[model samples]
Each structure stands twice: as structure tokens, then as C-alpha cells.
Target: MAKIMDRLLLLVYSIIGFAVSVVALLLVSRIIPEREAEDWVESLYGTDRLLQGIVITVSVIILLISLRFLYVALRRGNASSPSIDQRTEFGDIRISVETVENLALKAAAKQRGVKDLRARIRIVESGLDIMLRTVVDGETSLPLVTEEIQRAVKEHVEEITGIPVSSVSVFVANIVQTQTFKSRVE
Candidate 1:
């Protein structure tokens, strides 16, 4: 909900900024008359209490939005990537999701018949849920290969990271075809 609101605000802020910039450019370049700009401001200044209140409210909202943009831009790099955080006796241990994905890929690739491999890691309440998408050689048994991949990935990640694995899901995306090339004679 907060992310959605932030995105919506960003979109609104961008549109307003773009419109204001274009208007300023037009005024400076004499495409729009200086008198017209002054007249618009004067009209707003002479408006009723409701109109004045709305103008003030919009100004405050724009100011707040600009400040938010600055804050997000100047924040530290630690918040950039999601990590699995554990509170240890020593202190805290942080493992990046990318690191876990790489571990899963490493373990799965060591198994026979895997032609290509890709991994995704999701941090759940219980532990990590790993998803592996792979392409295997056509000659290999799918069930056996997938099971080995699941077990290997689960054990390897758990042993290395000390984080309990909720599940390992293996998806066989494709099978590599065995192609024979014909000898060419001159």
C-alpha cells in the first residue's frame, strides 16, 4: 500500500514538474507572453478564500513531494537490495538474495544432465523458498534429475547459510536436443 502510494505520488509529481518546466520554457522563449503569466498569478491572488486555500494546499503538497524525492535520492546503499537478516549471538548476519540464488545455481549445475540453469529465491516467514528453472539433456530421466536438483540445492543452501529452507521447486523448462552433423566432402 505504501509502495503504491509512493508510485502514484511520483507519477503525479513528474507530470506537474514536466508541465511547469514546459510553461517556464515557453515564457522565457517569448512563446507565451510575460503579461499572460503575471495575469494568471494576479487572478489567483485575487481569488476567493476557498481558491486561496486550495492554492496553498497544493503548494505544500508539492514542497513535501520534492523533499521526499531528495530523501530517497540521498539515502544509503544498504536499503537498495533485499537481504535475509539473522540476529546471531555475535551480532547480525546478512545474506543477499542474489547470493542464495547463486548458491542454488552452483549446486544444481553440479548435477548431471543440466544444460542450463536459473534460480530465484523468495524469503518467507519460515525460511527461504527456492525456484529453479532448468533445461536438461533429452537422454536424462526428468523425475530423477529434478529430485536430485531439489535435494542438492536444499541441503547446500541450508548447510552454507544456516537458514532453514521452506521448499525447493524445480521446473523443467526445456530439453536440449542431440543433433548430429553430417561430414562434408569436397
Candidate 2:
């Protein structure tokens, strides 16, 4: 609910900024005469109860929105990346997705067949879902290589983080050439 409110407020703030910019541009470019702009401002102060109330209410809202922006800007820990937040009896622990990706890459790199690799980790309802995209040596069996990668990544990540791994999916993107050079006899 708080996030939704923040997003809505941000959208309103953006729109207000755009509208103000447009008006300022028009006024500066003489498209809207200086006298007309002055008249619009002076009209707000004229004897009108409902208009004044509305103006006051809008001003208060904008002030609150500005304060919220300031609060967010000044707050610490605002630069955090996406992570898995967990709580235990001792304290709360956060494992960043990038860390998990590195763990997966580490596990996959130990495999003999994997030449180049990439990993992605997703937090699922059950647990973590890992995806590995890899380039393998042409001599290795695709099924065996993929299976090894999936097993190694799942076990290593779970062992290190103590987080349950729901799935580890391996994608065999490409295979590298294995060429043997023959010796020339003169």
C-alpha cells in the first residue's frame, strides 16, 4: 500500500513538473503575455471562498509530497539492490541476487565441459529458481553437461546459503569447436 501511494505521488509530481515547465516556457517565450500571467496569479487572491479553499488544499498536498521526496532522498540504505530478505532467531539476513548468480557461476565453472556461462536467480514461492545459460565443449555430451551443471549449482547454492532451491534449469546455448592439428612430416 505504501509503495502504491509513493508511485501515485511520483506520477502526480511528474505531471505537475511537466505542466509547470510548459507554462514557464510559454510565459518566457511571450506566447502568454506577462499581463495575462499576472492576472491569473492575481485572480487567486480575489474574494472567492471555494477557490481559495481548493488552492490551500492543493498547496498543502504539494508540500506534503515535496517532504516525502526529501525524506526519501535523505534516508540512508536507499541504494540497496534486489535481494532475498530472510529472518531468523538471531537476526535478519539478506542475500543479493547478484551474489546468488555468482555462486551459480562458480559452481558451473568447476565443470569440465562448460566453456562460458551465465546465471540468473529468481525468488519463487517455493524457493530460489536458477537458470544457467552456457557454452560447452563439442566433445561433451549435452545431457550429461547440463545435468552436472544443474546438480552442482543447486547443491552449491543450497549448501552455502542454506536456502532451498526449487529448480535449476540449464540452457545449452552453444558448443565450442574442438579441433586437433596434425603434425606435418617432411
Candidate 3:
């Protein structure tokens, strides 16, 4: 997507350059005397054959260069693994807060002591902020589990989305206890 956007921007600049150059050339031509302009054109063209040849050569060169660049861009697009589209806006490129929250919750759930994880994300001026509530094993130390969950969530969200995580607040809302066969046997 980025490639197309870049190409469009380049095309705009080229058009602007061409317009400016033509305007400047026209202004310079106006400053010269009519007789001098005629003489200059006559000397440059001679029998008119050279002028035609120069025009053809320059046109062919420009066409070839443009085609070469187009070919390279197409080949690169084909070679890419992800196959993303060729144009994207700055707003479209940004990751949403909801996506970050989902990633954070999933990462927290992967921790050893966590039974379940839920997260909420907020977008602040500085960056994204996440609040997580986790269910953990009753036998696990609350502080240790909370710290691990917080770290895991923060790191995973940042890595996946490339968004800076300002704060991760963990709330240990519940403790899960698993029933053991030994208790039943006793």
C-alpha cells in the first residue's frame, strides 16, 4: 500500500516540476527579442530534421525510463509474501486500541498462574493504556502473578502493534482452585 502512495506523491512532484520549468522557460522566451528568438530556433533546428530527431530521442528515453520503473515496482509487488495493497492512508495505517486490548488479554492468559484474562484499552495523548483483570491459581502469590501478567501484556501488545504502552494495571479479581483426587480419596 505504501508503494502506491509513494508513487502518487512522486508523480505529483514531477508534474509540479514540469509546470514550473515550462513557465520559467516561457517567461525567459518573452524577455528575448522576436528576431533573436527566430534566429536561435533557425540555428538550433537547421533544416528541421535535427529538431524532429532530438524530440524523438528524448521522448523514447523518457518512455523507456518510466517503463523500467513500472516494471520494477510490479515485480516487487509480486515478490512480496504478504501481498498487501499498493495504497494506504496514514489513518488507515494506525492500529486501533481494541486490537491492542485483545492482544494484551491473550498474552496475559499465557502466563503460568493465570486462569483467565480480560483487558480494556484506552488511548491517551502519550500512548495506549491497558487495564487487565485476571483469574489466577489460588496457590500462586498475588504480587508475583500480577507483575508477570502486567509485564507479559505490555510487552506483547507493544511488540505486535508497534504502539507504545504507557501503563498496564492488573487487577487480580478471582482465585481459581482445582479439585484434587487426593481430597476425594481422603
Candidate 4:
């Protein structure tokens, strides 16, 4: 998803560059008289064919580079999740990020008053960062619930995976409403 967004942004920039280059060329041509502009261009490169070819070559190169970027972005990610590369005497060990997310979700769900849970794991300079967005019962204390969730997720994931957790960010997106007897009676 992020790769697509980044490619779209680059595509926009490339289009803008192309448009600006064309506009600038037109503006420069208009600034000089037709014959004088022609002479100036011919004088710069000696032959019009060589100048045009050079411009076309550069433009084609730019286009091809942009196409390459788009192609890579559209392609699927390498068939692997983020993990630490550890080489021991016997063999290599890898601990996937998917495992961390699943573990965090499980730990967060175990907390009191949690109604729904989502977790995302990111590789950071310090270590892994876990972000959890959750829905909970409205009657629950937001701070307490969030705190426990953060602690549980960080502790559990780090303990199981043997990877350090830099931080756990909990976002309480929504709170569910529970029915009361008085409201139903009224």
C-alpha cells in the first residue's frame, strides 16, 4: 500500500517535470524571433538533428527510468516478511514480523474491556515499534486500559520473539455502548 502511494507521488512529480520542461522550451522559443531562435538553436549544436536526438534520448531515458520505478512498485513484495538475520554455527534463524503482530493482538485481546484490536509492526532504528488501534467498552478507564495493553503487548512480543520493542502506541478509536435496563424500560 505504501509502495503504491509512493509510486503515485513520484509519477505526479515526473509528469510535472515533463510539463515544466515543455513549457520552458516553448517560452524560450517565443522570447526570441522565429529566425533568430532557429539560428541560436542551430549555432548551439551545429546540426538540428543532433540536438533533437540528444533531447529525445534524454527524455526517453527519463521516461524509461520512471517506468522502471512504476514496474517495481507494481510488483509484489519479496515473498518474505521483515525479520532479523542471525547466523549461528549450525544455521540461520529468522523471526518474522507477522508473528509479532499476531502475538501482540492476542495479548491485547486478553486485556479487560477490549472489544476489538488491530496491530501493526514497524522496524525502527532502536528496535521494533508496535502500534495498536482498539475499540473498547465505554465504561472502561481509557488510560488504564491503554496502559495495560501497551505493557502486555510490549512484554509478550519481546519475550516471545527475543526482539526489543522500542515502544507500544495504543490508539482508542471507538468505544462501544452497552444497554442499560432503565433505557429499555423507558
Who wins the lDDT comparison?
1
Residue 105 Cα positional deviation in candidate 1, in Å, after optimal superposition? 0.9
RMSD of each: 2.9, 3.5, 17.1, 6.2
lDDT of 4 by residue, 1-186 (tens): 966866775787678688868867876878646787668677657766877887777678677767777777698876687876557899988888788899999999999999999999998888888999999998989999999999999899888887889999999999999887765654
User: By summed lDDT, which 10 consecutive residues of candidate 1 come out lowest?
Assistant: 43-52
Q: lDDT per prediction?
A: 0.91, 0.91, 0.74, 0.85
Which has the higher TM-score value, candidate number 3 or candidate number 4?
4
**Residue-level error in angstroms, candidate 4, position 126:** 2.6
State the lDDT of candidate 1 residue by residue for 1-186, as single tens digits: 866877988998999888879988998998988898788678788866676887788789899998887887897867657899999899998899999999999999999999899999999989999999999997889999999999999999999999999999999999999898999998
Q: Can you write out model 2's per-residue Cα lDDT over 1-186, one digit (the tens) per residue?
A: 978989999999888778879989999999999898888778778877787898898778789999998887798864877999899999999999999999999999999889999988999999999999999997988988889898999999999999999999998999999899999999
- Pairs that collide, model 4: none
Question: What TM-score against the true fold does each predicted structure earn?
Answer: 0.81, 0.74, 0.48, 0.65
Q: Model 4 residue 143 lDDT?
A: 96
* Superposed Cα RMSD, model 4: 6.2
Query: Which regions of candidate 4 fall more than 4 Å away from where they truly are?
Result: 1-51, 66-77, 182-186
Question: What's the best-to-worst order under lDDT?
Answer: 1, 2, 4, 3
